[model samples]
Target: MITLVRTNDIVLISLIEALLREARVPLFVADAHVSAVEGSIGAFPRRVMVPEDHAAQARRLLRDAGLGAELAPSPGGS
Candidate 1:
């Protein structure tokens, strides 16, 4: 899986999850358990990831949804 976004904003994460689900793209919320364990501190943010094969489509979908700025930098800094 490739991470598309990491954030402490539960609202943003929910929005992304909704978008991914509606589009039928696979979604994973990493570090969610960690956040729960940590009591939702601003540390150890939750990550939104998609399957590698769907990453481009997911990224495009998110960017179109006005979330480009929230996207993680592409691997290799591209």
Candidate 2:
């Protein structure tokens, strides 16, 4: 899996999840429980990940949604 976005904003995360779901892009939220364990104090930012093969498309989906700034930098520095 490739990391797409890492953020402490739950609302933004929810929005991203909804958008991805609507687009039929499979995603996994890592550190979700960790954030809850941290008392949702905006620490332990959660991560949204998708299959490696879908990373580019997922990034594009997010970018087109005006969430490009939220994206994790590509390993190649894109």
Candidate 3:
């Protein structure tokens, strides 16, 4: 899997999750539970990830949803 977005904004995370789920893209939100260890002070951001096979489609889907700016930088040098 590859990360597509990472942030402390739960709203944004939820939006991405819903979008991906609706599109049937494989999804995983890593570090989602780390807030418990960090006292939910926004110390650790959650990550939105998709299977490598879905990466391109997921990125396009998110961009179409106006979340292009929120995407993690493409893996350096491809």
Whole-model lDDT values for every prediction:
0.92, 0.91, 0.89
Worst 10 residues of 1 by lDDT: 35-44
> Which one is best on lDDT?
1
* Per-residue C-alpha lDDT of model 1 across residues 1-78, encoded as one tens digit per residue: 989999989999999999999999999999998887888568889999998899889999999999999999877575
lDDT (Cα) of model 3 = 0.89
**For every model shown, what is its TM-score relative to the native structure?**
0.93, 0.93, 0.90
1 versus 3: better TM-score goes to = 1
Residue 66 in candidate 1 has what lDDT?
A: 94
Per-residue lDDT tens digits for candidate 3, residues 1-78, read 999998989899999999999999989999978855787688888899998889999999999999999999877533
Residue 71 lDDT in candidate 1: 96
Candidate 3 worst ten-residue window by lDDT: 69-78
